[model samples]
Target: MARPYEPGPSTSLSTNTLSQTPSSPVPEEDDDSGAASPELPLTMSASVMLADLPRDATAALASVGGFPQEKVVVKFKPVGAAPSLAQELCKISATRKFEEVVRYLRRKLRCKDTDSVFLYVNSAFAPSLDEVVGNLHQCFKNGQDQLIVAYSMTPAFG
Candidate 1:
């Protein structure tokens, strides 16, 4: 059976202080001062920075690895009403629609028939705080409570 949890002797209290105070109990046994404490690791999911996604995700998913680069998923969305392409791209970034903005650029932005490519989101951005709170139960049950997606960004790697 697993050992029951105990309130460890207060490591933070100094031995001198304990000695001065007769009522205090002896210090708890410690394996080593340098040894790491038994603690839970953060439950956060890893995020995929735009540049790293293509090389990293593809290598792990062989189906993606050998496939043509053009077949890779492209996320984009248009931002603000703008006739100028640069303005539109700038608006996308400012709005934080990481996926949607990229998609729009892929289809619209061009130079000598070549496009200056990057990531974008089509949506408003990471979901609002209320939306996240609403999904908290589902997230917790699925071990995804720590997983947070920005309202505009579809979280490149979930």
Candidate 2:
């Protein structure tokens, strides 16, 4: 049978770099050089595993007040040398994927299969093709209640 383990003086070694008795509960003082010690005291905090959901998914779902509107207004803007559309604004189904917007732009521009087009939301970021249009509208809609989409013939915005 194994002997019961015991914590002796040797086992309870000083974990801190400062010279202090084991019984002392005081924190070590800063150095005369006016620099704080690199070592920091350990702290315990409780955390919860929020199921099998990503942080953005949870936050997006939480911020949206209710079901997305049936349709969302998308206002397209041309960047760089890209051609402008006669009708700059159009209405699209909210539940449609972002790929629809891309396809629509391509059809309007009469682009060939080899031609590449880039789209950005609020002229800021290029979202995934599979992302929902409603979510994009909800997140980046302008004061005029329209989703501002900046289109380019090549990768433009950062």
Candidate 3:
């Protein structure tokens, strides 16, 4: 029997990091010699499974009133794969979880919050709309019954 795949907790998945590099003579508070913060810079991305589907794409755009246009991306593979594919997959995943990805980018890269996150789309790889919608609907139904919060996240503060 083909065992079904299960997703672990999403906590570790949040990849928010500083968007910019710190400037100049490192702010020295007292003479602690050479001590650096543990926090490091990182990039953000995501991946979705389309095991039994067609095509591959990254993101779709949605307009939210007042808020910036929400750019939702789709990824057809899991977290790890070939180098190039993995990078693309991560990009897509990042788009889906825009807030988390942006937080990481801005925090690590020191990018401005106003900067636009170009959600990439691997349309050459994504599955068809019918399959995507159907699978999502089924997942939604199952999660609903179990009261699973599939894709909820906390708000980010500056």
Candidate 4:
């Protein structure tokens, strides 16, 4: 019969004292700190320096070395409390920045500097303004081959 593991003072038990196979290594009661315990590596901690990593992450965006030849179709979508555009669809140079789309929306809406316009792709996430439009379209375009951009006057998605 096995006794309850009383993990203190080396557990001077008559039954366990003469065991062949060693039990799991447990921390002694004297050890107050978890110094021997291993820690899990954080995903966010794994970062690369700018010098080590490429500036452009995608091949689609890296094609900017050549002249702006390809055009991506951008379809505007209105989110909660946002007004819709007169023309929902538009064609833009693939090499252009996402900032261009934001600027275009601002212009169409006649938004002042004080007015904030938030834009998201696929109504899921907001891309950086500096991100290339071609890369976004290539990665997240809808079935109709259109880059669906959802815009909102206020914060919509987390």
TM-scores, one per candidate: 0.17, 0.59, 0.17, 0.58
Write model 1 residue lDDT over 1-158, tens digit each, in one string: 43433434442444687566533233333677654344522112422346556765776886532322221222223333322344321222222333443344445544234433323222323433223222322322223222222122123323
lDDT of 3 by residue, 1-158 (tens): 42232323322223343654323222233356465322322222222456653333322222211222223232322222211222321222212333454343334334465653232112122223223222322233232221111111221111
lDDT of 4 by residue, 1-158 (tens): 43344544433444556665443435333467746323222223344456544555656567546543389999999999899899999998989999999999999988999999999999999999999998898889889999999999999898
Per-prediction backbone clash count? 25, 0, 31, 0
lDDT leaderboard ranking: 2, 4, 1, 3
For model 4 the local lDDT of residue 51 reads 57
Point out the worst 10-residue segment of candidate 3 by lDDT.
147-156
> How many collisions between residues are there in candidate 3?
31
Between candidates 1 and 2, which one is better according to TM-score?
2
Off by over 4 Å in 4: 1-69
The candidate scoring highest on lDDT is 2
Error of 2 at 14 (Å): 40
Model 4 residue 128 lDDT score: 97
**Which runs of model 1 end up more than 4 angstroms from their true locations?**
4-70, 73-76, 84-120, 126-158
Residue 146 CA error for candidate 1 (Å)? 27
